[model samples]
Target: MMQNTALMPGSRWKDPAFWMLAPATLFILLVFVYPFVDGLILSFRPMNGGGALANYITFFTDPHLWKTIGTTMSLALPATLINVGIAVPLAYRLRHKTRYQKIATTIMTIPLTLGTVLIAQGMLSYFGPNGWFSQLVQALHLYDGPVRLTHNYWGVLISLVISGFPFVFLLVLSYITGIDPGLPRAAATLGANPYRQFRHIIFPLLLPGLAMSFCLSFVQAFSVFPSAVLLGSPAGPTRVISIAAYEAAFENYDYSMASAIAMIMGVVQLGVVVVVLGARRLAYRGPVTGGKG
Candidate 1:
């Protein structure tokens, strides 16, 4: 048998593959790791000169600060669920080549190009009390009173849905398309109906991708700032954790407190991600065959 020199302890460092990872490792260190470590350290140095945990104590003690976590989760979870729920069926239907596939994809993806601020401004113009939506509702006599959609919780929720759907849809669409079409076709041939084929053959394979999509969408919705400020009552019902961190950093000029709050925000996001990924482990992990299994 030939000896594997590349596996040798001292010779591994001379491998080209090891050098190929240098740029990415350096980039990650500079872009993600360094900032996170620095912020974590900064969070300990409270401006008021208390213990290392002073900022965390203040955050937990104050209702105004701690309540933002619940508020953010309320918005993030529902928005993520709606996006993923809708995207699954839609992506399934659009997995195969169709006449309207490109057109539909282009229309759906248009929202991704629009910024959060622009979407918020548009909602205010179109969904405001006296705007087109309310006017149309009144014209059609859908409701007796003014249709209040903007500057409230509903407005923020709508913004999140509109912006987040495209992302989830695209991710799910890719995952669905990557599945072996013959698997579903084989199920169909074996007397399985459409719903049965989907549930038994397709969904198990797609669960991992869906979990990842949900985590990403939840993170995007959780960190919402401009929409809450522009379209919702930031001081009251729609106040998210990001707003609290912003106030601590900019308004109160408490970098340490802001860093602490950011850390908390990261922790909550990480918890949700961990739960989702853990659940994904129970899903199917078979090979993704290209119809040749």
Candidate 2:
């Protein structure tokens, strides 16, 4: 008797679509899952051959190591806020097609192409103590002394902004444009001014995207190492968590400690992401777009 192929066990595996996921699955397993598991295991293995918790305990007990969290947060939070704050309004303004929109976007994207180290170098030249900005200030008699911008907190902060703002802007712009133009127009027809329309409609729809953008920007800023070392005082003000992790792995040749620090960093970042994503649920849960199918 002939059996039905459709009813055969494991028939679904024969389909091409089922096999199509193989590459991505293999990639994730090799690249992400394997590394994460390996790192997690390594974090528990201390170099001094102590207890499983030795790495974590040492990280917490050492004031110098623990303090990197606060330093990273100080820089990350402000930079994320500044980038999102600026991107939102600017994105809202540029959402609709305009003559200068392309030009503006091109200019904004220039920074993204320039990596962190290049941006730090450029900032050092432009915003350095005796750089053009300081020279211009002096030429205009704006200040008696040279303007100090690099090798400090402000230097790192500025570098973060320059590198981060483009990402935030593009992400926010995509969300804003996805919104139906009719929503704002309808609000306008109802006697709502531009401000009121945006307040009632645009801003509400943008919150979810804003939260995501903030999380991403914060992560980028938090992982700052090149900028902190090149632009800011790495040994003091800009000694971020990445620097601690780097020192552990490369400088001190302690892979276990580095993995532990990395795990902690991931946990902190995950916490912020979870909180922001949770808060997003409180916003409008309807379709992101105003248009109907």
Candidate 3:
């Protein structure tokens, strides 16, 4: 049995296992947690003079903020759902099945390296009205004019799904692979058909990973910028909160207000993660294991 860790002054702080976490803890403190607290504190203060809740009031009371959230959800919800839905099946297919799964996964991850801006540019080149696709469509008389996929919500959604699917796929695959192969075999031996086996035996074990993928994919799509700015009219239909914050901070030089928006974003994503994990707890249908398979 493990010793009572709470009694010692430096049991956890000085232990090798705990020390191993120091770098990560320091990194989070310096990069994420520290900046987050700073931004939260800054959000409450006014830029000109007053110390009232003006900055937060401006953000919370704005109809534009609510509208932007709707737009963000319009894109984020569908994109995350599509990404996770497609990824889970792909992940399941690759788990302990294909020898080239790693290579396929690497290829799928190529879009991640391209960055949002580059992908937007590439889509512009490939899917723009006057671009190659437009030329082909015109030559074939597919439509009266160029198919406008860019500079819209569809463009942003497409970019997010393309970029995010691989991340979800990989995350789900890691979890899927962790499932004990014997569980499925046992189900099969008990005369469970493939579909029943998957429904009963395989799906439950993947819930934790599904929750994780949903949270990450949602967060990624929620904070989307280059895709919205480059591929869509961010100030128009695709106006997301991140764009609003960017405009406030850099374009308008409203750092305090920008900080408020930033704080809202962090809180919103945190809430989403918590909600998703809670939903997973409600929906999970997996066998418990004491250790790694």
Candidate 1 lDDT score at position 48: 98
lDDT string, candidate 3, 191-291, tens digits:
99988877877787777777888998899989888899999997799999899899899998989988988888778888889999998888855445432
Local distance difference test, each candidate: 0.92, 0.90, 0.84
**Model 1 lDDT tens row, 156-253:** 99999999999999999988888888888888889999999888778887887889999999999999999999999999999999999999999999
Estimate the TM-score of every prediction.
0.94, 0.94, 0.90
Candidate 1 minimal-lDDT segment of 10 residues: 284-293
Better model by TM-score, 2 or 3? 2
How much lDDT does candidate 2 score?
A: 0.90
For model 1 the TM-score comes to 0.94
- By TM-score rank, best first, the candidates go 2, 1, 3
* Cα displacement (Å) at residue 188, model 3: 1.6
Candidate 2 matches the true fold with a TM-score of 0.94
The digit string of per-residue lDDT tens for model 2 on 109-171 reads 899998998899999999999899999999999899999989999999999999999999999
Order the candidates by lDDT, highest first — what do you get?
1, 2, 3
Cα RMSD of predicted structure 3: 2.8
